[model samples]
Target: MAHDALRDELATLTTEAADAALDDIDLVPTLEAARRMNAADRSVPAAIEPCLPAVAEAADRIAAAFARGGRLVYVGAGTPGRLGVLDASECPPTFGTDPSQVVGVIAGGDVALTTAVEGAEDDEAAAVHDLDALGLTADDVVVGISASGRTPYVLAAIREARRRSATTVSVACNAGSAAGRLADIAIDVVVGPEFIAGSTRLKAGTAQKLVCNMLTTLAMVRRHKTYGNRMVDVRATNEKLVARAFSLVQDVTGAPDAEVSAALEACDGEVKTAIAMLLTGVSADVARSRLAEADGSLRAVL
Candidate 1:
């Protein structure tokens, strides 16, 4: 009385799934296999090149919304989710952006960030709930990350975001994915079959991370977070960052360390203002005004 129908359905579902059985392969050659895996990773960037236009478009839209005081929200599951959270968390110290300006929403919430959540990615309704919790509006930008591009949670999140009139971008490894279709902009970096087959954390994850870096970094650059290629807006929260700020000021204005220190003191340790004061030979207040007029871009005022 075996359930043949259920057995067949399970088999069909797993038919194309990547085989995790590598035990039969010779044990001593495993290091060679890992090397080959690393070699395969090199193709990920090439795969992502064609999608740069789409990625850039998304970045431009994100910058616009951000300039208008909208938030940038990242939604994903598993590794992709963790990557989004990591990127969002770094924005504050890296670009001096408010923590609330960038947000990360994982499928199973905070706990899932550290541990796997059974069936969390299958919860379609949960995505809507997460968006609701954020009070998403038309001014927001939502980026959904999913290697397979079929995760119900991510797809539903992007769909809901779009319905709310928010800008939605989908980052995926597979072409023609549901996540892509549901988003306003789709960046599909087809890195081919994974080295371990379907183990997307290898190639797909790398591509997603790279794209995420580009998206956020380029947006910050557009927002004038950098001045003359230096992170002028960086939050000098530690001794290391304070030293970095001093070095950046000295490098930008060709001033001695003593002058840099004086300028920093005048600007209350604000790197951008200090650089402005040093380069423009003005008081801190006048330097602040010049920087404000140039939208905090050193290149513009210099």
Candidate 2:
């Protein structure tokens, strides 16, 4: 009976449906198979186009929460869980956000990220425990991701988030998913069936990745994490990043390389401060003060 119930839920999800067109994919030439796969991948973007309005709304909600000193949390299982973790982990280096500002909670904890924990996705109680550990609040935004839209762990997390009055957004590859029903905003990409039947790590994963990108990237933009298209808040932690920081400062200020280097050094390699100092001919201390006054908006400072 338990197996029957789970099978029924999966039956209703388009992500689990088999594609007859690719039935003989394994028998095809390597190049032909690759071409077919690439062709199918192209449809993911189109599937997400209609959901942009919902994605925008969710991003706005998240940005508002950030302004109010809130955090963004993603919860999921399997491939969706890894995607959430990837996005959350990237916030710091890409946008210079605090690690705590964005976080990912996967079923079975960090151990589930690499090695699949047996039955982890079915552990609803564990989901509740994980969300509780975060101390979810009304100011936080919780995004629940599941390719099937019915992962038990993800549904439980969304329910717990709702109970805490946190904003809940669901990303599902199927329309009218269980997770979607529980969220305040539902982003259903509905990318049809996958080439490899139930292997959602393909098309469904691609759709989820695109949606996650828009949510965090747009939220950061709203928070003044960039100066125009340039990622001015990027953390210059390595040699390549350090060079990119210098390049960004020079590009934005159009200052000589020597002046850019001097400003970056004076500002301790803070890209935004270096840009501000060069553009305004101010001392590093003055540039830092102006940035703080403008709420860290380089545009506003200039």
Candidate 3:
């Protein structure tokens, strides 16, 4: 894109506009500046409220894809790209999903996560290459995240994803986004101008993170990754999480510490199986069979 054309495009986006109200932000005291930024951040959730239905719909589509042995792939640039990676990385430890189950692709690849890659977001062909490397399939769901909704890389990624018959979702902080038009599901949270003009890493970044949280969290919940409010599928990889698992098992079964420890050991520290064994007085093998029969839903088995 030419500089003139790009400038014209940016002029039309609400997110790119400068807020005259914040022109004096730098002149204010440090505390006042922080307050102003916090106040700006607080509006992000309300802006997203109107987009919940769209978010829920996208999440359900993601859950359906997962059930079909598909994956949830997030594609974006810059801060949005980093947010996608962060969300995808948390899935394994949080919900016991394979690393391949949730994927994140940035315009410039892994190196971009730490350092900026100049003009990478404008290379639309790179976006197609990244998705192709994933062996894009019809069963997968791809989400394009771009604050301006006009990002060339994200637009290309969404288009490529749709071309492959994969479910496509667009998440942006602007109305009438190009990405939104290309996606099957459009989630646009129009939060207006940012605290710092044209810097989307602030309000836009926060909003994207929150939206991604809902997408991944609810999708896992729908797939029986949790047993009610507890993370029954949590991978106890560390001391804190192992502790959490023990407390979670005991809390759900009302079992004594010794009994919970025994059940956990018997079930190989699998929270759902341990809870099942303790609550029903069943052996670990029987509990595992029951859980499998119940489609991994503890509530159903109970």
TM-score of each: 0.91, 0.98, 0.98
State the local distance difference test value for candidate 2. Answer: 0.94
Estimate the lDDT of model 1: 0.87
Give candidate 2 regions above 4 Å deviation. none
lDDT of 1 at 100: 93
> What ranges in model 3 sit over 4 Å off?
none
Model 3 superposed RMSD (Cα): 1.0
Worst 10 residues of 2 by lDDT: 5-14
Worst 10 residues of 3 by lDDT: 1-10
lDDT string for model 1 (1-302, tens) is: 35796455333332124545443345648787776677878988999999999989999999999889999999999999999999999999999899999999999999999999999998999999999999999999999999888788999999899899999999988777668988999998888766665577888899999999999999999998997578998888999999999998888789988899999998888888888788878999998888779877777877
Clashes of 3: 0
Candidate 3 positional error at 140, Å:
0.3
Tens-digit lDDT string for candidate 3 (90-199): 99999988999999999899999999999999999999999999999999999999999988999999989989999999999998788898899999999889999989
| TM-score attained by model 3 | 0.98
Off by over 4 Å in 1: 1-28
Give the root-mean-square deviation of each candidate in angstroms: 3.4, 0.9, 1.0
